[model samples]
Target: MIKIAAMGDNVVDCYLSKGTMFPGGNCLNVSVFIRRFGGVSAYIGAIGQDEAGSVIEKALHDENVDLARLRILKGATAYCVIGHRDADRVFVRADLGVSMFSPSSEDIAFLKDFAAVHIGQSSGLDDHVSAAAAQTLLSYDFSTRRDPEHRRTIAPLCFLASISGGDLSHDEALAIAAELRDCGARWVLVTRGSEGAILLGAEGLFEVAASPADLVDTLGAGDTFIARTLFGLIAGETPHALLSAAAVAAAETCRYFGAVGHGAPIKLSGVVPELQTISS
Candidate 1:
C-alpha cells in the first residue's frame, strides 16, 4: 500500500439544506477518499473540543480512518455555512476559535514514509510545517498573488500544485505555475470547475476537460480530485490515468451535497468512459 499523509485544517461543513449541519474539510475528506481507494493514509490536523468536533472524530472512526494524530483543541471548529441555490453552493466562512497553529516536526517525520504529502492551500501559509514534511509536496492553494515574497515562500516546497479557477486567471495561472516551477515544483495543476483542469507536468502544459454530469454541490471536489490524482500517480498510473481518476472523483463529488461525500471511491472502469485526454 502507498502510505499517504495529509496535513491541514478540519472543517465542520454546515450545509444549509433548509438549515442542517454537514461534515467537511480538505484533510479529513481527502484522507477518507485516499483510504477508500486503497491508500494507507493519515490526517494530521487540529479540530475543536465542541460537539461538532466529537461528531467529526466519530465520523473519522466510522470511516475506518486512523485517528492517532488528530488533535482536538479547546474552541469552536473552523466552519463554512453553505447555501445552495439550485445545485451550486455559496459559502460563508468563519475561521474564529479554530485550533491554534503549531509546526510539528514529528508530523513531518511521520509523513516521510508516504509517497506524497498533501498540504491544503490554506495551510501553505504554515511554510515551516509544510517545508519540513516532505521533499515531494502537493499544495492545493490557488490564490493568485501579486506579492513576490509570498511567491518566494511557496516556491521552494511544492512539487505539484492544485488550484481552482476562481483562485486564478488564465494568464495569472500560467505565471503562477511557472513561478511555482521556478520555486521548485515539478508540476502545477489548475482546476476549472465544469470546464476541466490544466496541468504543467514533466512533458509540459496540457488541459484535461471535465466529464459531463448533473452538477450538485462542488464542495470538496477539488480535494477529492487532488487525492485521487496523487493516488493514481502513486499507483504508477499514467498522467491520463491521473487526470481521468481526478475528473471522475470530482464528478462524483459534485453529485453529492458536501465535501465529505466527494471521497467515495469509484471504480477505475467507471471513470474511463467519462474521461477526455489532452495534449502536452
Candidate 2:
C-alpha cells in the first residue's frame, strides 16, 4: 500500500447555503479522500479542543482516516463560514493560535515512512507549519511562500507546485513554475480555474481544459482535483486516468455548497466517465 500523509490547516467548514458543517482544510480533505479510495492516509494537523474540533475529529474517523497525528488544543478549532452561489463561494475564516504548530521531530520522522506526503499552504506559511515534510511529494502553493527549511529539504524531491490565476498572471505563473523547478519540485501544474490547468513536466508543457459541469460552489474543487490526481499517480494509473478522475472529483464538488458537498463520496471508479484528455 502506498502510505500517504497530508499535513495542513484543519477547519470546521460551515456552509450557509447547505446549512451544514463539514471537516475541511486541504490536507484533511485530501487525507480523507485518499482513504476513501483505498489508500492508507495519515491526517496530521492541529485543531482546538472545542465543539468544532470534536465534530471535525468525528467526521475524520467516520471517513476512516487515521488521526493518530491529529493535534487538539484548548483553543477553538479553526473555522470558516462559507457563503456560496453558483460557481463562487466567499469565505470568512478565523486564524487562531493552532496554526502555529509544524510537524514535530516525530511527525517528520513518521512522514518519511510514507510513500508520499502532501502539504498545503491553506493559510500561507509562517515560522511554524511551513514546509513540514522534508522528504516527500509537495503540493506547492503559489500564494504561500516556501519555508526556508522545507525549500532546503525538498531540493531533491519529486513534487508538483500550482498557483491559481487569481494569484498570478499567465506569464508570472510560468516564471514561478520555472523558479520552483530550480528550488526543488520536479513538475509544476498551474491551474487557471475555468481556463483549465497547465502542466510543466519533463515531457514538456501539457495544458488541459476544465471538464464540463454545472457550477455550484467552486470551493474545495482545486484541492479535490489535486488529491485525486495524486492518487492516480500513486496508483500507476495513466495520465489520462488522473486527469479524468480529478476532473470528476472537482465537478462533483461544484454540485453542492461549500468545499466538500455531496461530492465527497466519490471514489476512483466514479470519476472515470467524467474525464477527457486535452491535447498536450
Candidate 3:
C-alpha cells in the first residue's frame, strides 16, 4: 500500500457568518484526502486542549487518519476566522496558537516508514526540511510563496514541489514550476485555480484544465489536488492521468463547504476575548 505522512499544521476554520467551524490546514487536509483516496495516511502535529482541537481530533479520527503521533498541549488550538463573499472565502482573523512545533529526532526517524512526507509553507518546519527529506521522499507545498531565495533553498530537498499559482498568469506559473524543477525538485506542480494546473518533471510539461463544479466553497481544492497528485504519483500513474484525476478531485472539493466536511458549531466566546465581538 502507498503510505504517506503529513507532518505539521492543523487548524479549525471558523466560519463566523455561519457560526460553524471545520478541521483544516494544508497538512491536515492532505492527510485526510490521501486516506479518502484509499492510501494509508498519518498526521503528525500538535493541537491544544480547546474545543477547536477536539473538533480537529474527532474529524481525523472519523476519517481513520493515523493520529498516534498527535499531541495535546495546554493552549488554544490554531484557528482562522472566515467569512463568505458570494461563495468565496475571506479570511478575517487567525492565531497560530499551539500549532507550530518541530518534530523530535524520534519523529524524524518515524518518517522513514512512509513513502513520502508532506510538509507545507505554513507548517513552520522549514528548518527541519533537510533532515526529514533525508529520511523519506518529501513533498513540499509552497502555497503562493514566491520568494526566490526561499524556493531555491527548499526546492532541492523536495521529491515533489507543489505551488498555488491561482493569481499568476500561465507563463508566470510555468516559469515558477520550471524554476523549482531546475532547483532539483524531481517533479513540480502548479495549481492555477479555475485555469487548471501544470506539471513538470523529467518527462516534460503536462497541463490539464480545471474540472467543472457547482461552486460552493474553494477552501480545500488546492490541498485536494496536491493529495491526489501525490497519491497518483505513488501509484505509478502517468503525469497527464494524475493531473486529470487531481483536477477532478479538486473540483469535487469545491462543491463542499469545508475541507473534508466534518463541521460543528463554533463558539466564538471560547476562542478568545477579542474574537467574541467580531462581526460576521
Best to worst by lDDT, what's the order? Answer: 3, 1, 2
**lDDT tens per residue, model 1, 137-235:** 454454333466765666566666666665566787677677767777667777777778777877777767898778877877877777887777678
Cα-based RMSD of the predictions, in order? 9.8, 9.5, 0.9
Residue 278 deviation, candidate 3, in Å? Answer: 1.3
Segments in model 2 whose C-alpha atoms lie over 4 Å from true places: 123-133, 143-158, 166-171, 261-280
TM-score of each: 0.84, 0.80, 0.98
- What is each predicted model's overall lDDT from 0 to 1? 0.67, 0.65, 0.92
Per-residue lDDT tens digits for candidate 3, residues 1-280, read 9999999998888887777889999999999999999999999999998888999999999999999899999999998887777777778898899999989998899899999999999999999999999999999999988999999999999999999998999999989999999999999999999999999999999999999999899999999999999999988999988998999999999998998889999876675445786787
| Candidate 1, position 141, lDDT | 53
| 1 or 3, greater by lDDT | 3
Tens digit of per-residue lDDT, candidate 2, span 85-183: 456876644444374466677877777677777766564443333344355555545434544455444433546665555456778667766666777
Clash number by candidate, in order: 2, 1, 0
Q: Point out the worst 10-residue segment of candidate 3 by lDDT.
A: 268-277
Pick the TM-score winner.
3
Candidate 1: misplaced stretches above 4 Å? 134-140, 143-148, 167-171, 262-280
